[model samples]
Target: MKYQVMHDSGPRLRVRAGQWAFTKEEGYGLASLLLDQDFIHDVFTSYRNGSILIYYDGEVENKQRIFDILDGITIDDLFEAEPTQTQVSKEITDDFYWNISGMIGRRLLGKWFLPMPIRNAITLYRAIKYIWNGLDSLTSFRVDVALLDGAAVTGALLQGQYDPASSMMFLLSISDELEHYTVQKAKSTLKDSLALNIDTVWLVDDDGEEKQVPAMDIDKGDRIKVRMGDVVPVDGKVVDGEGMVNEASMTGEPLAVHKTNGKTVHAGTVMEEGNIVVEVYSMNKETRLNKIIDLIENSEDLKAETQGKAERLADSIVPYSFLATALTYLITRNASKALSVLMVDFSCAIKLTTPLSVISAMREASDNRMMVKGGKFLEHYANADTIVFDKTGTLTNATPKVVDVIPMSRRYKRDEILRMAACIEEHFAHSIATSIVNQAAEEGLKHDEDHSEVEYIVAHGIVTEYDGKRAVIGSRHFLFDDEKIKLTKTQEKKIEKEATEHSVVYLAIDGKLEGLICIDDPVREEAKYVIEELKSLGIENVIMLTGDGESGAKAGAKSLGITQYRSQVLPEDKSRIVEELKAEGKTVIMVGDGINDSPALAAADVSVSMKHSSDIAREVADISLLSDDLYDLVTLRKLSVGMLDKINTNYRNILVFNGSLLVLGVMGLIQPATSSMLHNLSTMIFGAMSTKSVLSDRDISNDIEVEAIQVADAS
Candidate 1:
């Protein structure tokens, strides 16, 4: 099909043939023909040499090569060499000489010189640049890289508008990984997350009633409430609520978590709380719980962690290629060996393997409900030595239910106190409010739509009158600072226990502390397996970082066997911690599900976030797990390590394969056909290797590094 040149910058032209985009080979080929027929023809005719040679002649390849030989020499120098008396009469060189000489005058000396030869030269130059640029992107220090955008890749395949050689290399490489056994295993992650039924949504009713469903709408450090019938919104420690929760979705355990104000809970767990308010601290995906799920599911990442040696080697190859060619000729005094060195120095295997491993690992991770956005992070994940975890979302669930309600004043009945708090909290959509309202409902109290005029306070407390007695429910700090309410000893103890065991909600009636409610967020059962797997994968240190109170954080950490812990840590602290680890020469991989974790994730060697991760976290994370299962972490590490191994092997093979050709060429043992076949075969082999990234090993065996996640129910 005829394709037109759609774009041109000097000699670099982009032509679209049907749906394909062409750059070097096909593009250069077409441009060369145009240059010769139009521009070269004009110059030849202008020079009065058009009748001497034909432009479409099949002998152009040899003609161009000969032109290169006499590149700087004038027409007279060619004939100056003395010819034997017998050479002119019957020799092949003699016959070829005049024909070439005349052709040079007609084609080489005119516009054809720049249009045909120079065009092909520039195309070759562009091809080499594209390859080098791709390699640069894989290094620690980012280099300018151009992508064969979807438009480019698709266009080339459909319209045949691309350089056939370059396109074939990339697409064929993709095909190779697809055919490999291990690469196929990684490819299965995409479907698993979608199949797990972990998606969370908000229950907004037309009647103005809204319920919070776990797995969605998770803001970092925001309180979320789960009712007796609903799912937990995110991963968090129980802080001021008591409830029974079913966590089979995450932990594969049937036992319920009797979570009360200090335990962690996972998303997708069913709530069995009697009554409680669960403060939300990490609904990172904006939907409340999807962020945690997204983190656990993405077992793959695109970050590459090539050592200094690999990087230096990648950078040195180009110069080394020229050096090898020069030294071969110097040592052997043979053009064949030097040519072999130069021609076989493409660096395909070394360049392709690193990215291929990342790609395959990412796919494998997704099979276990992990989604990785790129191959770059997958490389980095394998190198992580220290993993900083967020306690609330990382180790605990976000489903806090109302467990206990204590009345300080004898004038108020326990049920009346609960109903008043629930009535006033109806306007708020927070987790605490849900616990109160649901608690009131379970007692079969018919809610009164008529509410006495109540004032909505900001971050302090709510104020209103109940049963003609002034009543309010708010945090201790808010009441003391905003409303001038002092706490009694008994109330202080209640608040202390709430803060220590779990998150708490403070209730005050008529300007004094009334009582406290404790909530719990239990550890996810899958977390244990995930941790064990990571340890098995060779990660010796597991640290928990949380903004929650120390006792609450430690309580949950101990239940899960994590001794290294940091509580009450802010977002800035998280970032600083990662930097400190990196400074200590530790390769840190951070797994988090909140916006607060974005900076830390960006700062770490590699960061893997959940699909429900906050926008900022997702933006910075190298791998995105669309599913909410920690088991995916194990698959990611395994696939990544395995993939890298394959890549290294391929790199060594390329060196040996190409190096052997130079030796054979020097000994005069290799023919043109044999050398050409090897060269072509290497390209196919490299492509096939890249395809292996997709066709990963299907075994979810003992080899992979799975995160030790402990899924538990807080009931």
Candidate 2:
């Protein structure tokens, strides 16, 4: 791959490879390939001009690396490459522009060069499809905008108004094309948003040494390692080792499937237990995970409650349109007036604008690094009055730190207890376990593999054998009640006094309390501000639900200014509470990021999961925040509310403007042709407006900060 640098300034680099350097597919491939580089932020490729524009991290080493990568590329690389989001979007946009241009060009050519008879014949031929659609709707005992449109065009043809009939058909064709383009473009954008982005993977070399490498660098037959709690990065067969792979993301099953050697596993699935070295067969665009994403993209039309209502209302209004047309003809004895009334039916604008607004709003959400699965979820989020938050990853820092470790037993020192805990906990992927392991590392303690096979009890504690003795570590209930690990009154009082505000992990050795580890999961910096914003946005109840101790839960709630909280709550209890809230007629939005949160997430009207969440949690969530920012919650709320407002505004404007056109035509103030033109023109205008961004161009964080300052000053 030979290329010349055409221009370079700071982080922007532009180069030309020469005319016809690659095909369109190759261009898309190149763009996706380039985008995978760590140094490159964005890339654009044009096959026609053989040009590439790369926006990259400005570093001298990075610049040299970019050139080195470009020089090593071969045609074989382009053949195996897959298109990026930008490429998909570019293709859709190009298709739309070409389609519109072709439609207009043909229409103009016919009017200028074709005979009047040919034009009328062409108009009549196009009118058949619309008439058939109208007749089909009527046969099915339904009246809709199609019937109205058909009637309007048919009436013009019958009255020998060939030019008006042609114009109506032309406008109708434009509407259809616009609707198709809007939907396709929206789906493309959403597919990009919902993509399962895996940045890096652990690659196993020939000698069996494992090293972290960029996911893109893995090729066919390259072995990659997947451990418990990590998402599998490629679609491959397990060549060595075994694990319980959670295929919930693909199959929607809650259970994890066991996979050993020779069994194939998919990307996007989570390894629940054990470890496996996978021989990669496919990745990126070719993986089975992409198939699931395609299915999700097809579900983009899961209409919002408001959107559904608007569509139903649009269809219901068709009978009234026919009724008005009939009344106009009978009263004025004028076919022109009746036809005008038919031309301006409300259903077209209503149906088109509502969906456009929804899809556009979803695109905006994706742009802001939030993946809203469907329009209905956004609606649910907006109308929700009550919100339930899972404290650990939602309200607090995702990476919790171990603040203290107390050894109750004189047989072991504090460091010894920490080392033993880290050795066992290192086998799991939970945040608390990570904290314990990190603490051991910070204290310069090496916790070797010292325990027997460890068993993880979800939402409880881990159990294993250490030195031929039963070792347990988990929640208070898991240890005291479940395991019958008795704690002396003095030790219990000591724990209460020392770890009151911090979440505590209890450790027991052979049914006796041995130590206590305090985990400091601090509240997010913007959490309180997000809660305040939610309240200002009309949320009535803000509640925290956690499995942490009562004292810890209370402390978290107090810090976030939340008045209500339920501590020591089980997963099932969380779901029950959400159900109870719904029973009270409160729309609930649940935010969580763990396996335990899955049930409650499903029970809520809308559920949001944060980035770096468990794979199962991400799969179950209605919306996923790609950025680790609680403030995205506030952005989501504002966007949803704005969507509803936009829909209403479009509805009102469509009705008023079209209604006026109808009245004017009926009162002999305008010709039927003028009315037809204005009606279609207004529908297109409103539709284009619907695709506009609901949220302002200003950054959400900056706006929130400004508003917060203003509020403080006002007080």
In TM-score terms, which candidate is top? 2
Candidate 2: residue 101 Cα off by (Å): 3.5
lDDT of each: 0.55, 0.86
lDDT (tens digit, per residue) of candidate 1 on 456-526 = 44334577876676777775555666678787787667567545677556677777777665556677666
lDDT of 2 by residue, 1-715 (tens): 8899999998999989988789877887788778768789888787767898899988988888889989998877875356677767876787788889999999999989999889988988988998888788779877777788878888888888888878878887888888888778877765765577788899999999999987878999999999877888889999999888877667766467889999999988887667899999998879998877777666735668888898899889999999999999999999888888887878888988898899899989988999987789999998999999999889988788998899997988899899989988998778899999999999999966777999887788999999889999999989988899888899978998898888899988888888889998888777887899799999999999998899988888998899999999987789899999999999999999987787788778899999978876887788999998888888899999999999999988998998899899899888878888888888889989999887776646544684576578559
Instruction: Please report the candidate that would top lDDT against the real structure.
Output: 2
> In candidate 2, how many clashes are counted?
0
Ten residues in sequence with the least summed lDDT for candidate 1: 42-51
Q: What TM-score goes with each of the models?
A: 0.53, 0.86
Q: Which ten residues in a row have the lowest lDDT in candidate 2?
A: 698-707
